[model samples]
Target: VASKSNLSLVGGNFTLQDATLSASSGQINLVSVASKGEIIPERGELGVQTPNISNFTKLGHIEMINSRAETTGSPSGGISIRGDQFWMDNSSIHADNLGDTDGKYIDIQTNESIQIQGKYFGVISNSFGKGDAGHIFINTPYLKIDQGTIDTSTKGEGNGGNIDIKATKIDVIEGGIIASDSYSTGNGGDINITATESLSVTDKRIFLTPEQADFTSTIGSASLDKGNGGRTTINTGQLIMDGAAISSNSHVSGDAGEILINADSIDMINGGTMTATVMSQSSGQGGSVTLNVKEKIYITGFRPGLSFTTTDVFENLQSAIVLITFGTGNAGNVNLLAKELVVDNNASIATATTGLGDAGNLTIEVDNLYVNNGGFISNSSGGIIGGKIFPGFGPAGTLKITANNEIVVSGQGAFSASGLLTNTLVSAPGGNIEIQTNKLTLADGGTISADSLGTGDAGTLDIKANTINLTDGGNITTSSAYAAGGNIAVTTSGLLFLRDGQITTSVGTGVGKGGDITIDNPIFIVMDGGKIKAQADAGHGGNINVKSNQFISSPDSLISASSKLGIDGQVRIDSPDMDMAGFLVILPGGFVEASMQNCNTRDGSSFKVSPRQRTVPFENKN
Candidate 1:
């Protein structure tokens, strides 16, 4: 590397294609005013330590055409420019595999404007255990880069640098890529951009087209990398990129910084994801963002969690939100008052911790909300959706799910929350709403469950396991009074119904003698297989408490003279020869099952029965 020639020039428009520029074997410098030239070495090498060139002052249009750089041999560099309006076209530049030689691929220290068009400037640092650096610094406030295949690549675990512009506007369009590059930021500017103009993307691809690139070492392989964000402010006027990427920056070791964006209009037609992120040491936040988006906002990627936060808190009452666990969690408290919010099952929006605060309070005031192929809005079961506060405070947050499409809520993996329905159809042809558990209570409609269960306590609890369970884990609570029309509640340790389900109301612990087993309309209370056992009882050891479970027991306190068992429907206790009334006794609807297995009584009050056996008000037996 010491036995090398150093070619030096002053200024001129130069073209270098198919040439080998070696900083480890040769050194070439250009210090000219107006030298229009070319360095297309068909089979030769040009060595130059660009930063080593002493040209504090120079006025020239130096152009670097298509070429390859091999500078990973010593503490030398490939290309360094401090000129006016320097340009590098359809070319490639990089250095790798020579150990820590303090080798840099390209250094642009120019204080004037610069443009990288139709060029593929690549870099790979620390290849084969070697370190590397690269850049195209626009020290001045003037730099324009639009169009090209800039595959800023890094191989092994080392990252190579390229494009370091602190300029005004950056327009990216056509076939431009920041592909095959990695980044680091323990110190320097991984990708520093402080533009006062616009930064927009049109029809472009930033991160490489999903062609997998392998790492060298099992741990630290890649040498170079793609672009990064050095606390950038992408202005709407400064950037008009159809496609581009803010690749990984590894040097910082810490999380990446925030990026402020001000775009007038954007339309993400297809492919490419808008991956905007921020790193909080303990709890970091991003700058304020506002986009007058006209087209669809396609948020895709593994890390598609975009967020904006500040220490500023909104105060009204007692509690305050100090930290937001997830970015999309704000969506539950934040109102999305758009004209339309359609969630295609094909398009999923997920959150880690606090997915959504409360669909209730997070007013999604849209003209329409369509969930084609099953779209869902959920929240953490532990997350709070505070109730409405009148004089003191506390109001129930609400989730208004209006849909022209079907709103079916019945799955093993269901979220914990309440919903208010405007116009809901439950049944075939209209749309079905199935509830596997009675944990739900609709304000108006929406939850018009048409399940097979005749009992509504569960509003639908259709579990058929060897044993049922409602342990410390899962909950089934109703905060406010939905309505006092004709809703019922059932809590039987035994199966409520083997044929249907239970839509019980009473909750907490020992709340009601049992949910108001109301007989509003013509209802059927068939004790065919199971019995309705309530913690409430008049006497005789019936633990059926009337009021308990924390809150006030429902006003099941009937005023008029109605049967405790309003049986307009059939009460066929068809436990034939088993003498069912011995076990299935009702305050209302009287006893209507068979007398006894081997005997009959005139009083019809007391009767004996065998163990584990009962009678059913079998069909045609009433």
Candidate 2:
């Protein structure tokens, strides 16, 4: 059906299948009423149609399958649907502007629920000319989309329109998408989602086929050309993602947008990812990702047997939350705030740059944090460029973590240990790592390190905690290949314990000096067969300074600052309350003999107690 004017449809139960409805610069209204009500129509100043129902009652169901409703032109018309429940299968609602005028909006409101099911169908608002695209608004109690999409884009000089969704519960699964993009100079539209209860995005494919290798459930915005990507904001009670992706990315010279999420709890499992990235060959700056969760944030790596095959090669990717730049533009930052955070099973939270630009920082603040089984938190820079190694090519990003309660890192993964690290491989300066917590524990080969594998100085590592413990090969280290090693500083208020662990800084090659080690203001320090060394290959060794109230070490424990071909560094220990000789008391190895005389007259009438139960010869004499 084609109309040059307004189109209105009202019924108790409305269904449109395999049909098309077109309106040219006119309004289209579909209202389904379940109860008795009188509909009143009114016209606004611009001859816009508005329907006001007196004694408004309950709404009825509206279904559309393989159908389309669209308006295309300069200053295109709007589409509005009001019903109790709305279902669309293989259908689309589109508002397109082909002229120099701005397009109109698309509004959908349902009292019960809204479900969109299809493989590739969508509700789209687009701009193909110089005009801006239209906005989309959806309001419902529950919203579910299975493989369908709700999106906005701008291919012209004008900006894209925003999308706003408000629902109690939302589920987007099986390659479903909610996105906005800009393919030209215009900026992409923003997306805002607010769910009162929960929000989920998931995919079911465990083994990706060749055709579906790049496909997953997604919610994000992209800039493919000269336009900047759009921001994405999500607010919900609970957020869950499995084998899904949430990103704001750029492929060209446009900067990627930021992502913000607020939830009570968040879970990312089975290769789920949250990223802001600048792809290769792009000069656009990557965007940032911020997650503020009240309860906890849990992330697990890809499940076993989950792999993608390409050209006889199988690749497995871990679950991650990252900000990366592979272009000349700098990468963005990743910030997380939660009560508790757990990254396990090869999962990672990182910020990195593999291009000429610098990497961004990674910051986390939580009550408790656990990184186990090859989980990692890092910020790094430098990678292969033009088929050659670029060591420290750009400045690596820093990492800072603050935990109110405790921070624990333990276990190892396939190639790395669970740890916090900062690395650089180019000629630029490396990044630093700082952590502050009430208690810090590293065990089972866990590590905290800063390394420089190029001709650049290594970064520093600083830690402040109430108590520090390392056991079972847990280590804190800094190293450099051809530059000065990074320094390590640790301050603990309560105690420091190390068992079969190490704290070291070393330079492998060149005349670069080893880094220094400092431990200050600990009540007690104990090292049981632990090692603290700062060694250099060709340069001077680093100094070690330690100040504690009490210090104890095993015979096998080692603390050395040595250089093979250069001057050895100094090691100073200041402990005022440690005196092994003064605090120890020795006992004699002799027996005591006592002679006892008893009053016979008083003992005969009284009760006697025998302490040793021994018989005397005086009894035979009596």
Candidate 3:
């Protein structure tokens, strides 16, 4: 199998199968032959050497089945051809090494009457070793990839490119599967189609998600992009990819080989999806991307998410386009932004395997966005999408952003409990927010609404395991239609302070314990420009209790606690102006036998008319 010098010659007619033509470190060529004559070289190995190249015209009737040819050593190729008229069936060329002493590139320069089609995969290395001139092109003829897959991992020690067709017409059929760029980075160069060629890639899916490769150092994983599928540079020529799918995983690449589409006019159409991108770090001084469609641009399936994670410091965008047509074959007007973008709504991008490559710094600022159906957006890497999900938290890694005219949120577990989405609100000048460790207070203009579903104040609207403090200047309101304010739940085992604003709770019956409106810290609740109104008329006793360190309040303010209440610690009844309406009912045996001097006007009709009260905490003995 070491045919390092197998140069087979095919002419007028020939047939060879199950034979291994191992042209290792050698050349395989075809001399000038007449048209209509054929040559068949089928199956087995061909050029498994250093630099296996095929030069000249008409290497006709070639059938490659489960066969392979690759560059051996550091200066070779699997099968380098400059021939015409081929029917390469299920063959592959995995160009692993390149640009050594033998050759730094693999070039296929030909011009003739031929038909190139069939299954082709692997590389046309553009970087790695020989970072230049490692390309593939069938000069001028009708070339077709009936049903095949062509990809590359053009990484360390790789050659030049995947395919470069400077022909009249080209058609690509993806065999109903995807042409993926799944590695971390370093997918061979781009696919460039020059000339007035007609191109088409049949309906197929593709992806370029992050790879789980272990590149200990960033350089070890040095790659510009997954794969620049293809970009066209037309100079008064028509370029079309009717049905095709192009996707990329990582964002380590840029404008496919600078597909300089400097055309006089172009007609682009796509019924499929096209999403090719380069990683952020690799885009050299990245600039804005815009795909300009001068002539008719047609688009069919509008895919879901499309945006390369590029932070180009350039103004405007460097356009990328995928025009489409309707079922009538007529041009379907495409409303584009100087640049054209097409998304196959049918395509679904996969999640990441590692934490590092969770999301792309991709941002889309659209003047208009429409949702055909109810859609959702979620994340796993626990990333932040907005410019800065959280302020001052930078190194948190990849972020995702979604900005639309309208948004809808439904589903129980759609939004995770761990994820807290705080509106990017800027406080008005001189406006303030206050927190009272003692109790809860709401200002006149402040508002607090519940984003929960149940009727039980889910938890404490304001929870201070210890104590809370509130100075005030903002209206605070907890309006829960189904749930109550569970407002100011004090499991703190300390004091609760209520200074201002109105306290309103709307909840049904529940066996859960809510905040006890009793003055406990020095155990005193004080109120000035506020009111406490509680109603337990539905067999649910909700008492409103306020303790004051130094009882002082406005006379017009209403402090009403109409349910059963008790004070075990201390009570400072110094508010002579503010008349407290409501009875203080202590629980059965809830308080230790005690009586104070001038112990208020205890009504005989109250829950408790005795002079006994509790002055100790749950832990203290009587």
**Candidate 2 ranges with C-alpha deviation above 4 Å:** 1-4, 41-50, 212-214, 303-314, 383-392, 577-579, 589-622
Off by over 4 Å in 1: 1-6, 25-28, 35-58, 76-78, 95-97, 109-113, 117-136, 139-163, 179-189, 204-272, 276-622
lDDT of 2 by residue, 1-622 (tens): 4544778899898899998888976778888988998878776332455566545678899999999988766767788888889999999988887778888888888989999989778788888888888888899999999989998989988888899999999999988889889899989999999999999998766654555453578899989999999999999999998878888988899999899999999999987788887877789999899999999999997743333311012346578897877788888988899999999998999888877778999999999999999999988887532246644366898899999999999998986799998988867888999999999999999999999888889999999999999999999999999999999999999989999999999999989999999999999999998999999989999999999999999999999999989889999999985557887888898866545555456534567786886776665545
Stronger candidate by TM-score (1 vs 2): 2
In candidate 3, how many Å is residue 460 off? 37
Q: Residue 433 error for model 2, in Å?
A: 0.6
Q: On TM-score, who's better, 2 or 3?
A: 2
Model 3 off-target regions past 4 Å? 1-8, 13-16, 35-71, 77-84, 93-95, 98-133, 150-152, 157-159, 175-187, 204-243, 247-271, 276-289, 302-622
Q: Could you tell which candidate, 1 or 3, scores higher by TM-score? A: 3
**Candidate 1: tens digits of C-alpha lDDT, residues 340-361:** 4444322222211222211112
Q: Which candidate comes out best when scored by lDDT? A: 2
For model 3, how does the per-residue alpha-carbon lDDT over 314-403 read when each residue is reduced to its tens digit? 111112231111011111111223122222122111111112221112222222222111111211122222233311111111112222
TM-score of each: 0.38, 0.91, 0.40
lDDT of 2 at 217: 81
